[model samples]
Target: MSNIAYLGIFGPGPNSSAAIVSDNEIIAWAEEERFNRIKTSPNAYPAQSIAFCVKEARKLGLEVTSIGYAWDCNSYSELATANLEQTIAKYPSETDHISRLAQQGLNALYNPTKVKQDLGLILRKLGIELTDQNFKFYSHHLSHVASAIYTSGFDEAVVIVNDGVGEVASSSLVYVDKQGTMKELATEELPNTLGGFYATITEFLGFKAYVDEGKTMGLAAYGAPDADIMAVFDEMVQTDGKSFHYTVDPRFRYSGKRTFGSRFTDLMVEKLGPSRPADVSAMIAPYPAIAYAAQKKLEEVLFAQMKYAASLNLSKNICFAGGVHMNCKANGLLAESDLYENYFFQPAASDNGVCLGAAFLAKIDETGEIPKLPSLEHLYYGPSFTDDEIENVLKQCKLEYVKSDNIGRDVAQHIAKNDIVGWFQGRMEVGARALGGRSILANPLNPDARDHVNRHVKNREAWRPFCPSLKKESFQGYFDTVIDKSPFMIVATRIHKEFLDVLPSCIHVDGTVRPQTVNKDINPLYWSVMNEFEKITGQSIIVNTSFNVQGEPIVMRPEEAIRCFYGSGIDVLAIGSFLVKKGRR
Candidate 1:
């Protein structure tokens, strides 16, 4: 009955993060990459992140009593060893089993003993005891599921967690009852993972795998999936009612040689032609078409898998988690499907969110009760800077700045004048997308906004589309879609042709857009800025992109934001209540 403070830790891999839960409420959460300024540190521990959570909790008069590690590698080891042994017996010539065994020996997925020691060291540094009674571990997929279902506020829902690889299973389907009891029905093990398949294709297309999948999704709208490519993907995966299996011609499957140099790339090339060079500047023939084909195939397989799960679970509400759920295009299909009445994709759908899931799972195990938290109303749970912090950073850099009473309206007015502004306010967001707390803002109506951002600020592909953050009430006026409340920018909805020219900066080449619906209650300053922009231009949308350069992680601290403002092509910066402009002293 007493408030229990639980700390959740995820990763020593990509998208590592930490979260703190006080009984039924999440007090603070943050990804490690945000604090470290690294783009998903695959091998870094969440020491700084965990320390931040503890410090943040103390500020709120709470003490973390237990730590929940987000993965039980020992359980995964048992399952994987058995499964691989079975596969080796069944397929004598296949090398996937051997390669996977090698990776397992390296403890790529996890190592219980090693991780416990590391956690002990980190927790002790934070003045927490390192006892077995104070630490717990949850299975990877279960943690992913809990993150979605517990925060979803759905009494019962069909839970699906799909990612590159969790221990051994890449995807899992489960049914959660109104009492928060979960029954996992099926799992798709490694080598057969859709997450891996998509990552392979993303790499083949010259973008970073696991990181630039959004690029591939955006490019999908530009071309149609070739029937031949679809045939190849169809041959790679097959599904039954309750589960799915992979038949990727071993020659085309992952062999653990190079990240992108797999039999999979060769097979894709055989089917779709040579892969695109990563440095290519133009959206030429075959690449965009390949992206389209790959995305379409992914949607087809994922949708079929979802259909099978829905047939078995019979839940009107669905809670989605994992890396694959980050695919907004695929999410759009699921959202529009007639099988489910409502679907919720956690804002932090990637591995970065597993920390939250792990904490919730630990809470449930310790107390035998599901957290009584409401639906995830907002993701602004990370650290927020004080006005003094922002002013100190500005003064340290000797930058001329103006403090305004109405920062939102002042920033919005500058954006209306065609200047790209770095908007940093309140707590930092926990997900990959820059919702509002930390974002680069521009007038979506400006004809040159997209190109300027891509070429100068982002230094990424021009073909990639920017997202629009519009007031929730103005969503339907621009986009044509049935899935209404898209607060996370997870569903790529069709942009009304009439508004395409008006907000061309945010529209993709395929006429669809990923949009974040801003609600006043969740983010008042962001909503106010959007409203101010609307008052000036009669358009309710603004171009919203992560406030960082191409390869860097989103800005977290005030110093990082200030450094980024000076380093990039951003013309103005709205940090807390102060306004900073380029080339001014």
Candidate 2:
């Protein structure tokens, strides 16, 4: 009998994606939003994304035999149905007409049979017949653990998954042995969720809850963490040696609601002073202090949990996953503290990458043995274009582009002259952070480059810091702490005192920099441009930001890249081997 192939799907929320795998390899993986031009969460099922994965598998002449859903709807059947009923019961008397209708919609969304019907429809669109035996469901948190620990290449490690409510758990701690067996040590269930708490604070601080947490993180640098504010959080969220608990404040508790209720904002005002207004210019005095306090309290509680996990597992290696790990500053603090000898956070740590986790776990169940999977060295796992695809888009737009045999050197030359370059190369990346594939490259040496990109090109909050793409070899020279291996842009580290002014564009106000170290082997073309930039200037760092503007998804095609180049203040566009100047056509 031949080994079974698995197709993984993540849907019913944003970051809908699909992953296809044979017995031996991950044939392809992609987020539906990448193709559909949506941001993190999409409401529909991953039909288009599954189609892409199926097409990729067909191209490789592999047949998919099993389908995996990252979320276990059955696991949440009782709890979810109960929660929906409670909401509906309270709706008529306590809720308005609009609120009552919304709860009615939630009733249908949480129905287990509705989930199966949606899955069937999604499978049919992908040309796969849905069958009970052919499909398997994995717990959401377990899928996250599998994604991190399996790809970590660690023989044994402790795994931690932290995100918004998944089924009933908000945080989970498990131990994976040398043979890849997972043992659930403990879990902190809903209403006590760290992710939900952080998101509430995020919304209170005048930003989109799930989406703008990064902005609040950046703003933390400007204020001091107030003891009073920290005490408030400490009172609400408690951590023991082995397990953690949250004493829910009815004003601000996680009920698995899509949006935080008004009581959440009211509590923030009562505890931390008035919440920050949404008007960007109104960002003033106490807001930064509140952000600082929230961030510090979060780190304190989270690190305690990590320490408990470390004590129980007795492993030097740790595999961290979920949206919380996206806090690069906190990750940097952990890396600097020497808690773990090795730390692994997958490139797509959020819900988007759980598709890979589901597929890997399904593969293990089918074979009854852990396959020898290769460590992930690169994240170029999405769609790629051919030379003809590139030229055809250019021709369709009637734009003149010059094909270059040496695009790396030419693009480097433009950057050296302080020109902003839109770089689109190879396959699109599968995460929030843009690596080399879809990025905006600028000279880190330019004193004005950070403001130029933030204000002119990205039109984002000016205080938000830009990241540096540094040559891996130069890691020792630039940073105080010798963290030579951060490829995912998920870890923040301190900049050397001497190099702070030198790389001002990439350094945050707090003197920390989130750097993605580049190597020649993983991304040769991107590395070539960095090499040439370093040759021109003594610095081996370049300001690397995502290719998209503040509110848009990253550019997915050559035509989108071209449109962005012309729309923004960018001077040059480099897609494949072709180069187009903003006004040269």
Candidate 3:
């Protein structure tokens, strides 16, 4: 293994993160939101995340010799300026407005020298320093691709990256051969993005763009096919079945004054009626149908792209990254299809994963080859607390708690009793999903469990469905699907008809569920709790959601867990080995 250590920084935007790669392995990875307690941590510098990575790297006797940033600011500046100029030329009347918007957007794109200065400030704050020569800026889509392909454990694979404009490309298809050679096969440039199309609809439907696209995904299941809505969406994004390219109509996305407005234009409001009010219930007729149409269109275009990628037959294995791939419903369809013999989805497929991707790119740049690495097993790559540390927090808070002789059994018993539990175990998960590391656990059999948690704890949309964390062995029995393992909860599958009534809370209105199959060896404590729950209730599944209240990031420390336990409707706080309980709900 090479002795060189590389530090990677993702963004000063949403889902900012940092990672350290050394000795051909990821030493640490974390998102800024987890440390800042802000959802997505937009515009945050990720200083805390970098500090954590540095501390973790030090434990392994490693020091960061170089740094990699996820974006090539120079390329982005040139492309963005050109795109803006073309837009202004197309609509001469809105030149001033378009130019102002473009200036604001361009100013926000990372400037290499400014980024180096910012990094120097952050490093100095952390009692470390590095020269400007150590920094390298890579293309955004390349980082997204690297994050998936390098950790996919596949010698060869076709990688598809789709997101809201990375540099100039919104979607890219790259072929990775056995020789580790990467070839950019096809790309869909800006203004023709699947992510932009979805985000536009997401904002129109009264949900925050980017942040609440998943809410739209969940609402889509409740919506039936609507001809008018589907037609409108069809007009917005046109896909060619024979090719990997698609065109998004600018009028519905970022055209004229709409670029400075709510992303969607007046034409969209005229076609679909005025945007849904934030206070209004999303369950209303046209809104759900709108979400459904948008989702279907996204899937349609995505499947076309994937099918084209497969037509090349560069490799049977396929890997996906970028924010758009976070749509588990689409991922589920890809998983069920015979398009690929094997599939790997990066858990942190969003910009948060770019840090790790940049770090890998730095390593490759240094070594001149992609390093062979094991497939990413679990996302327990964030901070972890010891029992002693947890106990100290408990004592400081003056909270009554008991150290469990068997935490798994104890937590399972509470869950069996229909109690919502905050299960804070080892390291926190790195992605949007909590997995088992930092999750709220509940009995899946209780039909009201979903509503109870949403009303009292999550404080979000009641129609949104909760996911299930099931034992790996029980996957085939509960879900009818060809794909066997989905450890990250990034794919949706249909629940078996017979078990529908048995695990009511876990299944969505469409009878589909996003499940995380827990391997015993990968997450022993989590597996043990499910195992014990099975022993008690004859069911090996539990409803698992991220351990956080509405509008907050998941808990990262014992204090945060304790605060969440007391602040919300969660019944028990099973943090580390200590169990703190409240009066039965």
Candidate 4:
């Protein structure tokens, strides 16, 4: 361990979360927004995030040897241009340079210089001197490929990673071996992504282009597709059911600026009809048929592409990571496809996993053997608060609390009784999906559980459905397929109709549900809750939601959870050894 050569550091966005890994194990991680809370400029770098990582590592008694930044974007401009030109020429435009988008300032958003300065500032804060060694830059798409392969636990797999854009490529297909050797089969660079097309559509619909595509995915479940719009989409993006692509016209909406406009809105309206205002609560199952249609089209193209990639390496398997893969619905489509016998999607499919992916890929090249100590289960990869640490905070606040003997089982009993319980166990989760560690638990079988949870802990829109976390054995009776074990809520599956009546709140109005299947092997604490719920209700499951109310990030710390609990109308709040009920203080 002392002779370890480097630490791989990756950030999904200059504005986003950071992750660090050594010897293929994640050591320290944090989101940039948590430390600053400003949602500020990426140009400022993630110094606060860096400081947390360094400080957290020091506590673990390990000095980071080498730091790896997730991108080598030196040729970003030239590459984006060439890729966009190809898309434009093949699509509606005829030009070499598509849009005159400027990324000069964007490049500096969370740049490497800022990271080093932030790292130095942290050491200085601890009264230590700066060192000559600095963070190293790794290629961006390669990080995506690495994340897909390394975490995938596949010796050989066909890796396909597609996102809006990376430092260099937008979509890359790599053939990888267990020994960590990767061969690139294809690279579809920027302005040529199907993902980008949806992003533009997202922006035109009055949402943030990059951040709001999930909204589009959600919206798509409601509408039917416009035949004409589908035709245009198909015309621009050509797919042979193996290789799929669309060339983006640089003009009209090229610069990644003017993220919203009436022109594209009018174009979509001209083809797909007017866009529906997203009153998330009132949307009928088929009301937004256009969204459904678009989703169907996107899945058709994406599934074909996956099959194509699978066909590329019939002898190997398939693995993936990227923003587009976050579409659990699309993943269901691909997972059900006959192209690959096995599937793995990076839990942090978005940019956040790039750091660990890049670092792990580099590490694999160094030792050719995986270190088996740290597993990727549960993603308890962020900061943790100790009993003493939490105790001091409660003492400082002069708040009274109950110290429970068995935190997991005691809380599980409350949930089994159909009580909504706010649970804060250990380290904060790193990715988008909240897996038990920082979550609210409730009875999934209670048809009114959704309404109660919404009215109480979440205040979520009615049209939005609550997902469930089920114990492993109990899944078979409620769900049609438990073979995949989608513990991350990545794939939304249709529940058995007979059981839907029993768990209406857990089942979407459409009869589909996304569930996290918890086994003792995956999450022991989460499993305890499910097991207890079964002992009481004759079923083992609970409705789970990210542990924050509407319009807030998931509460990360004990204090945040405590504050939110008091602020909102929550029933119970449990943090580590302490328990607080409504006004229990």
CA lDDT scores, all candidates in order? 0.82, 0.79, 0.88, 0.66
For model 4, state the Cα shift of residue 293 in Å: 2.3
- For all candidates, the clash counts are 4, 3, 0, 17
Question: How well is each residue in 39-137 modelled by candidate 4, as lDDT tens digits?
Answer: 312343456666676666666665655556677745554555565555546544322232433444444544556655665675477444445444456
What TM value does model 4 have?
0.87
253 in model 4: Cα distance from truth in Å?
5.0
TM-score of 3: 0.97
Winner on lDDT between 3 and 4 is 3
Q: Which structure is stronger by TM-score: 2 or 3?
A: 3
Q: 181-201, model 3: which lDDT tens digit per residue?
A: 789999988678988888998
Could you tell which candidate, 1 or 3, scores higher by lDDT?
Answer: 3
* Every model: Cα RMSD to truth: 2.4, 3.1, 1.6, 3.9
lDDT of 2 by residue, 97-127 (tens): 4434654565566565787788888778767
Task: Supply the TM-score for candidate 1.
Answer: 0.95
Which residue pairs overlap in candidate 3's backbone?
none
User: For residues 243-266, what per-residue lDDT tens digits would candidate 1 score against the true structure?
Assistant: 344343333555423334553535
* Candidate 2: Cα lDDT at 170: 80
Least well predicted 10-residue stretch by lDDT in candidate 4: 93-102
Q: After superposition, how far is residue 221 of candidate 2 from its true place, in Å?
A: 1.1
Off by over 4 Å in 1: 1-3, 85-105, 240-250, 255-265
Residue pairs clashing in model 2 are 14-41, 14-42, 15-40
What is the lDDT ranking, best to worst? 3, 1, 2, 4
